[model samples]
Target: MILHTFTLTLGSTRPIYGSAHELRGFFATKFTEYTELHQHNADKFIYRYPVVQYKMIENVPTVIGINEGAEVLKQIFNDYQEIRLGENTYQIVERGISLKDEEFGISDKIHSYVFMTPWLALNQENYRKFYTLKGKPERDEFMRKILTGNILSMAKSLNYDVPGQIKCDTNVRFQKDRLKDVSVMVFSGKFHTNFLIPDLLGIGKSVSRGFGAVQQLKANNEGGSTCSSSSTQGAPT
Candidate 1:
């Protein structure tokens, strides 16, 4: 699994946790719903996305590729330094372990995990090629197919297992201006969730990515939201 950390602004007092599948599903749904609700087709809103990060704890294996991907991650973390992990957030210099062992005076073997640098992809074919995925009433059934296939393909290319587990923070507010389908899909969940989009206006870089200090939550759960609570649709932002 591509084990990485994500930085976000905390929207609720509740802690957030989920499997990789759940997290991806959470975002994919958010994006799709928002766009559809605004009556925009998925193709129109869909674009090749960045590697959304998730800050990992010490001892978690990190494989940095020796390529463009590595360079991007390096640049990404340059200005960004903190991440919101569930309720607790931290700075990279304080929270981060060495991306490479030598910098930390540790042997490579002791680290075990390879520093997956960016340029390793030979043909440079791998990042992601997310096409405009049209959403329908039966979109849930297609989630596993599109989300699983695409993510797994990237992990396989990077030589990591499918990140079965994923963690994320919640988006404070829902973007109001979008597609009609997006709104329908967004509210069509078991319960309401905090994760939404950056804003009604899609400006700036991906809001999903960042590194900074954050407030922590005391609550925790397996996936989605409350076990028995209905999850509000989390359309991609």
Candidate 2:
């Protein structure tokens, strides 16, 4: 399958202090007619996987648009000159936008990916189950399953048919994070999977707010991989 993606990066005179959530709010408020930007329809939240995701890549505010969302982004690529986050106002000095058609779906070889932002892999119920696991091995196994399911959900959202069972292996470190002012468990680190996920695309929960954003790591001859320096370096604590 082919995934159509559009990425917009904004550069400001000063460092941008806003999180993805704030970035999203700025655009959603500006373009109230576009539901993809906010994933909300009136009072209820849209349950489908988000096609438009907001994030902070390398400390700069970035937005990723997929498929239909890409079309929406193209329509408003130059609509904003400034963004306000909390009490901080940033004047946009440089804007970069790129559109691409990327390969998506299962591949024969495994690819390595690192979470650019924290991966919200567990909910309240699963959070309790994860802690009750007997050992590290069990916990890792459980996480692997969760990661696989995440991929499957993304595929289903895009209407891509999975020809085979999805396989995943994770090497992550768990940590506590605050989402919407509520403390929650999140994961950081990398995973190996046969699925070909596009860069800057988000998985797991609250992806529209930038959690679970991942980028593929390019493999080197030393059997290690190097992540793109332009991508995220984890969300601020």
Candidate 3:
């Protein structure tokens, strides 16, 4: 899953609404919002660069990605485990970075926001189309620059170095590719023993499923999940 953290700048106490699908819908909505404000100029460069936007005019006072999910993810901080990526150690929480909950960081002028997720279905479809096309050397180069640049920029902006890059699958591949995905218990509450995920053996789904699902599950039982794979307890060699 993508690991990201956001501060509740709008207020000290915030609550999250909707599902992963709804959250994705909201991100998609940001695209439209950007367009309506005549901010689509940024999109032209966004998909091809390390920057979030080319035009600074539209950088409104809102958040994107994981920031929207800030309400439902408080206990998220306790889920972290250490991982070896390239040469550095990263705190991996919720299958990604182990950032402090609701903590905000700076990025020059704008407040840098962080968030993460498994590959959404749409993102995967687009990637397959772009990355799998053979003999298109130029397109591949562009993809590498944009995707890698974004990740690198993100790390550098946080004053951290880029470790080995992480690319999560569309929940499906995470399950089928259990040998690659790390296994961690998703503890349900403040208590370490209660887990949202049932078994330690988990795998991301390897198929495409429409929409996404997060939970309203209580500490006693976890709601239905989207899916991932189980792996040995440590970093991959």
Please say which candidate is ahead in TM-score: 2 or 3: 2
Error in Å for residue 139 of model 3: 27
Point out the higher-scoring one by lDDT: 2 or 3: 2
Q: Write the per-residue lDDT of candidate 2 for residues 1-237, one digit (tens) a residue.
A: 999999999998998888899999999999999998888899888888899999987788999999999999999979888999878999999999898999999887778899999999886777888999999888887787777777877877889988875656788999999999999999999998878899988878889999999999998112122222222212211
What shift in Å separates residue 106 of candidate 1 from its native position after superposition? 31
| TM of each candidate vs. truth | 0.23, 0.91, 0.22
Ranking by TM-score: 2, 1, 3
Give Cα-based local distance difference scores for all models. Answer: 0.25, 0.84, 0.24
| Pick by TM-score: 1 or 3, better one | 1
Ranking by lDDT: 2, 1, 3
Which 10 consecutive positions of candidate 1 have the poorest summed lDDT?
115-124
lDDT value for candidate 1? Answer: 0.25
Error of 2 at 216 (Å): 0.5
Can you write out model 1's per-residue Cα lDDT over 56-174, one digit (the tens) per residue?
11322121212233344444334444334334444444323234211111111111111111111111121121113344423332232222232233334335432233222122211
The candidate that wins on lDDT is 2
N/CA/C clash count, model 1: 61
The runs of at least 3 residues in candidate 3 whose Cα sits more than 4 Å from the true structure, single-residue gaps closed, are 1-21, 27-154, 157-159, 162-173, 176-237
- Against the true structure, whose TM-score is highest? 2
Candidate 1, position 67, lDDT: 28
Q: Candidate 2: where are CA atoms >4 Å away?
A: 220-237
